[model samples]
Structures are given as C-alpha cells and as structure tokens.
Target chain A: MTEEHDHSGNPPQPDEDRLAATEFEILERALRELLIEKGVFTADDIRIAVEAMDRKDPANGSKVVAHAWVDDAYRARLLDDSKAAIEELGIDVGPAPNLVVLENTATLQHVVVCTLCSCYPRTLLGMPPSWYKSREYRGRVVVEPRAVLREFGTELADDVEIKVVDSTADMRYLVLPARPDGTDGLSEAELADLVTRDSLIGVTQPNAPSGG
Target chain B: MSDQEVAPAFTAGQHVQVKTGDPPGHIRTPTFLRGKSGVIEQLHGVYRNPEDLAFGGQGFPKMPLYLVRFSQTEVWDNYDGSPKDSVLADIYQHWLEPGAE
Candidate 1:
C-alpha cells in the first residue's frame, strides 16, 4: 500500500461546526438569564412549568362547542365561569384569572385580536397562528374588523353585531362560535373539524354540514 | 394594589394618551386605547414602569399608575358600539390627563 496514512507533519483537525439556534432560542436564553438575574423566576421553575404550554390541545375549544351544542345549561355555565366550565371537561383555561370567553351566535359576530401582541387563550387553544401575529392582522383587526373578517373569508351583514375585542388589555378572550346548523348528533371529535381556530375566533363561521 | 402614589393629574372620565419613548411595536399600552376616555376606576401602584425597564434600567419605581376604562365609541368615533360596551386599560400615572387635543 502507498503511504496514504501519512499526515505530513501538522494536520488540521475538524472545527466541529455546530448548528446555531434560531432567534427564538436566543431570545429564550436571554429572557431566562434576565429572569434569573432579576429573581422574577428561576430557570428550573420555567423548565418544570413549561409542560403546561405543551399540554394545550385545540380539541379543548371544540369540546366546549360540542357540549354547548348538545346541552343548553352547560352553555350558560360556560358563558359564566369559563375557566370552571373548561376544567369540567379536563381542559384547562390556565390560571390567568383575567381570561374571558365570548361566544358568537347567529345574531352576533365576535372577533378576537391582540392589538398589543399575540396574547391568546393559550391554555385552551394551544399556540396562535402565524397570521394572528402579523402586523396586518393586529392593526386591521382592531381598526377595521369587518374588512379583516372579510379577508379571512367571513362577511358580516349590516345587522350582525360586530364586536371587535382587543385581547390586548388585561382581558384575553376565546370565541365560542355558534355550531353549524344540523350537526345534531356528530361526535365530539367529528364536530371539532367544524371548529377551526379561525371559527372559534370569529374569523370564519362554523362550516355547515353537507346535508342539513 | 399597595404602592406609592403621585397627585392625580386628571379627573375620572377624562381622555389621555401614552407619551413614552418605548420602541414602536405592540406595547402594553396601545396607541388606540391611549387618549380615549370613559372613567378612572382605580389607582393601581407602580413597582416597575415598562418604559424604564424595556430599555434596560433598574427603574426606581416611578410614580404609580391608574386603571382607566373607555367605550369603543369614545376610542373610535366610527365604532358602532352598544350602550353596555366598554373596555378598561391600565395607563401609567404619566400617560393620563383631561384631554389630548
């Protein structure tokens, strides 16, 4: 064999280029550092509680809608203490006591938007969508809600009361849109499809069943 | 609930706006909510002012703040709001007054 194993005299070892974290990671690190420095929160505390953020499932919102569709009393209770109502079904609305849930019936249309930032009811609906965080959605939703709803494929009539809520302030909200007509006996999971995040936030009315 | 307080700058049901030098983005105090009026509900104290902290400062607990409520119509004239409609927002002591004209 030829002297292929020879390394001359000095050889350059691999530099081991590790992948860099994204902006999210950097910000997370910075915030974590600051939280520790300021003693506002500890890194371990965040690590332990971060599971709550992940435990959120969109199905939670659907469950509420489905139950409301079936039982009227349950619906009233939900409208009252939404946190308790959510918990009754094993879905948490979180300890953010300031959380408020608003429902949209056929006579009214309620749209939720965080004008200040992307503060949604993360406890029940999981994370927010990309469009929700966009400047266009934030500015337009608060200022010109009707137009924004139209862009989201929902056109409100002159009669339908349009309540554009600024989830920006202390009160955060989730819209319990009225269930589509004739979905009478659909199972919870089956009804969940009709309750998209958009529909729950009043951007889109619930999809009506094929036959009804 | 319990914090130092400065003299009241504006009476209840007065209009005011935010005048902080914080960065241009979705701040806690919204531009639209600012300068709008309904009524002053309570005087919430200030432990840490956002403007002082956002730019990296110890922010020696400035003069506390107050919570103000505003009707959608008052904030936006074209707002087709109902009689029983209103939203309350937290504005610092400096961000309030009688008028913003």
Candidate 2:
C-alpha cells in the first residue's frame, strides 16, 4: 500500500483531519423533517420505538439454549416450529405462519441471507447491522459462504457442511448454536456468556478457542 | 403507494429468471440470481412495492411477492458444498417467466 497505489491518485489520506461525529440533534431534526414530509412514520413514533427497543433489554437467545438442554420437548419444538417455540419467549417476528428456525452444530451449520430482498426478523433481533445489508456480502455469501464466514472471523474445517438458509415465505431460520461442551451444568447467565451474536448467525462455534 | 396493480401467473416449482441489470440504485435482488431458475416455494399475501417504499410509499395491499428457492448448483454450476448450500429469495411475480430450459 503506497501513495501511488491510491485509486484516485491523490495521496492516500483524508483531505482534512476534521472527521468528527455530527451532533445527534442535527440527525434527529433531519429525520423529523423527513418523517413529516413522508406523513407515514412520524419522528415521535420513531423516538418511541427506539426508546422501547432500548428499554427491552438484550436478547435471550441463550435462554433458548438452556431450555433446549433441560427440556426435550422444547428442543423438538424449536426444531419443528421455531417461530412459535421462540414466541413462547416473547419474540414475535414475521408476517405470521411463515417463520422458520435452523439449529447449527459442529456437523451441520446454517447461515441466513435474503437473496431476493432484505426480509429480516426485526421483531426478534434489532435492526440488522450494515455489513449484512451490503451488496458485497449479499453477492458472495451464497456463492462462497465459507469464505464469507471466514471474513466474519469464522473458519470452517474441511468436513463441516455449510448450509446458507435464505429468507423466504412459510419459512425463515435463525441459528440455534450447539451447546458448549464443558457447559453441561452451567447456570443460564453463565451459558449466556458463551452465546455470542456471531454464534447466533452460525459463523463460529461455541467451544472454539478464541485468541492466539 | 398508488392503488395500481401488476399481475403475473407465476406458480410454485416453475423457474422464473430474474431480469438482471434492470434496476438502478440499491436493489434487494442480487445480480447473480438474475436470469437463474428457482422453485416457487411460497406465495405471500400482499406487499407494497419496495420501490415505492423507498420513495415514501404508504399504506397498501397492492403488490404480490413470492418466496422462491434456488439451489447452489443452479445458481453456480460448480459449488463444492464444503458446505452443501441452497439459497431462497423473495421475488416479485413479474421477475419470472415460464422456463424453456
């Protein structure tokens, strides 16, 4: 990487060293004006929704794992009807009767993408991160899933099966990560520590040793 | 959204090739799946056109969207499945036609 390597051929540096986060009020005011002009979702509604989501606390994908451990029926239900099974935990997602869940273990892995459109389970998870919505990720995930996961910091063994589940009608899937090996009798909070958002997305395993 | 309508006779299991490079700006349908074959796995009730939504669409039961499934091999002739994988996508009925292949 060098100055001559700059694509635009202007030395590879910011034009000025004044990059700064804009005031939150400016953003809020702009959004408020847009919402008013749109006349559908008002800024007040947006404020309330954001506040409600913040007050709702973090997700409980880990609790679902704990239930799956102690209760056979729940595990079966999670596999059979993931939406209803998860809705029991109060996570309501979808356009109804069209939700699905896929469990990811060492042998069987599942990753999700919306090939046609960005149909996501917003009710369960909050707004999707920017990376998931990028064109580079959407184009490559299906064609080269393992490579995409590797970019996300997950490397798969040669024998692991990578199944990239797409969001579609009558079915949408979320990854139920395999329970950790040494966590057989851990408390729910302790177990929650092992379930990262990466695991939920099926990029990494629960027991993989992180750090060199 | 306006109360206008567009209709197509796209049924389940039939291949509908998405017209590639037709849309400008950001689009949900990927360029790879364009001109590809997929199975029509589901028919959703009603959805307003996303194009309209991007420009402030509001309140409608107008357009129809279908949930289609495509295999990795279908999209790409040689997928190792190191990682046996398949992809599903929600396509507007118009993006499809009767398969000749």
Candidate 3:
C-alpha cells in the first residue's frame, strides 16, 4: 500500500541514495576547496579540466591507428617516436608520460598492464576501464596473460608468443593490434570505426568488418 | 649524481638481474621482479627518480630507465603459457646489476 508496493506490478526498487565518500575522496574534495579558496585555481578551471578529460575517448586512439594502418611510413614513425607521430594527427598528448606503441606482428602479441598502479595512456585512450584498475587484473595479467586474455574472448594460438609489458615506471604503452584482414578496401574512417578501446588495451582485437 | 654525470651501465641485449631487497619507502620496482634475471631490451631515457619525488624531495640525479625483458617461465614457478612468452617492465638503472647470460 505504501510507495514500495505502489509500483503497479513492477518489482520493488532498491534504494538509490548515494553511498558515503571514501577517505581519498574526502581528502580530494578538501584539497580542491582549499586550493580554490587560496585562488590557486577557480572552480570553473577544475570543471573545465574534468570536462576535457571526460571528452577524451577511444576515438583519439582509433584515429592514430587508422592512419597508421593505411600509411606504412606513418606506422614506422609511430613505432619509432609515438609522441611526434601522434602529434602529426593534431592530437596533442601534452607533456604526458612517454608513450610507447607496441606493434603486434604475426608471431608476437603484446599486452599491457600496470602492476604497480593504473598508469595508462589517458591522453590517447582516455581513462582506463574499471577492470583495468581491478586488483585481479593487475595481479593476473602479467603472470597469466593467456588465461586473462581468454576471459576477454581473445584467444591467441600456441605458436604466438605473448609479451606482457608492465607499465611500472613513467612510460605508458598502447597496443597496436594487428589490422584485421579482408578490409583493404575500407576507408580510414570505416577502419577507425572497427577499433575499440579494448583493442587499444591489447585485451581484444578490433572488430572485423561485417560480412567482409 | 647529476643527470649529466649518470651514465647507463647496461645496454640493449645485455643480460642483467634486478637487485633483490625489500628496501622500505616508495620503490618503483615490483617485488616479483626482484632477483629475476632478464635482458636489457632498450634504454628508455633518463627521468627523475619517482622514489624521491613521491616524498616531495626533488627527484634529482635523474636515473636511466631501461625496458627489461624476462621469459615467463623464468619469472614464475609454473608459468602456464608458452615457454616463448615473456614479460617486460620499465626498470630504473639503480635496481639492476650485471648478470650471467
């Protein structure tokens, strides 16, 4: 008879109130307020920064991948100096950590993980997914990469050597997944559409063109 | 040591082993990698030491970092993957010592 039972044949809804903030969250909020009070940065500045970070996604990485796929010279340049090559696409990575692009070949497959912390290519691929930050992933990916990859529906052949690169220091890694076959006729934009965030992370390959 | 004064002791393709110790404080080295032998894949340039930077100290005497490669079987007791599989990590120069091939 009350609000709980007034759902008109629908099941009971769970409470939707927000949970309490953690210690780190409290500290961050306090620090932000203190900084704002001291005129270090205005609230608008913080909002703009957060918005810019949120606006970034896998598309930025996909553009780079697509460009490299069509241009052999660009691919070579990306492998040699990722920062400068990426900048040519007008994607500014800023004064970020050193970006290393790992090329996946027929015999070698590369996967990236941050065993110490979630040091990711945020400027290129945006914030990492939740699983990339989980303790399970951080611990297992290095030791049991094949099994971990299998869980993500990525099955590598026994002949293929798996290379797990742990982002333990200042350098960040981006996996250059092998371009799927049978799509040589596709345009760069269409190829970009096939690139997923998981592919960039080396957990999965880019989805192949449908019916191609 | 100043950045200019520090020279990379190890070079590409050279075999080396990570120094084994549980030194206290903010260390960038992972515990599992300690004592494991690997080859210096490449010199990844010099950077300010994160250990000192973490504690607000100037990360002076920037250290040369290298990409070290280790076979999966060598790193783990019973690595389930293929013997050819390997793990690579960006390790600082200070944590490495020359090792047998």
> How far off is residue A96 in model 1, in Å?
3.3
Question: Residue A47 CA error for candidate 1 (Å)?
Answer: 7.9
C-alpha positional error of residue B100 in candidate 1 after TM-score superposition, expressed in Å: 14
The digit string of per-residue lDDT tens for model 3 on A139-165 reads 999989999999999999999999999
Task: Compute the lDDT of residue A169 as modeled in candidate 3.
Answer: 95
Tens digit of lDDT per residue, candidate 3, span B1-101?
A: 55443688989999999999998888989999999999999999998899998999888788999999999999999999899999999999999999999
Pick the lDDT winner. 3
Predictions: Cα RMSD each: 9.1, 7.2, 2.6
Least lDDT summed over 10 consecutive residues: which range in candidate 3 chain A? Answer: A12-21
Q: What lDDT tens digits, residue by residue, belong to model 2 across residues B3-83? A: 565554676666667676667744545667788877776565465566656667662435667777777787888786652
CAPRI-style class, candidate 3: high
Question: Quick one: ranking by DockQ, best first?
Answer: 3, 2, 1
Order the candidates by lDDT, highest first.
Answer: 3, 1, 2
Model 2: lDDT of residue A9? 57
Q: Which runs in model 3 stand beyond 4 Å of their true positions? A: A1-20, B1-5
DockQ of each: 0.19, 0.37, 0.90
TM-score of chain B of each: 0.66, 0.75, 0.94
| Count of clashing pairs, candidate 3 | 0
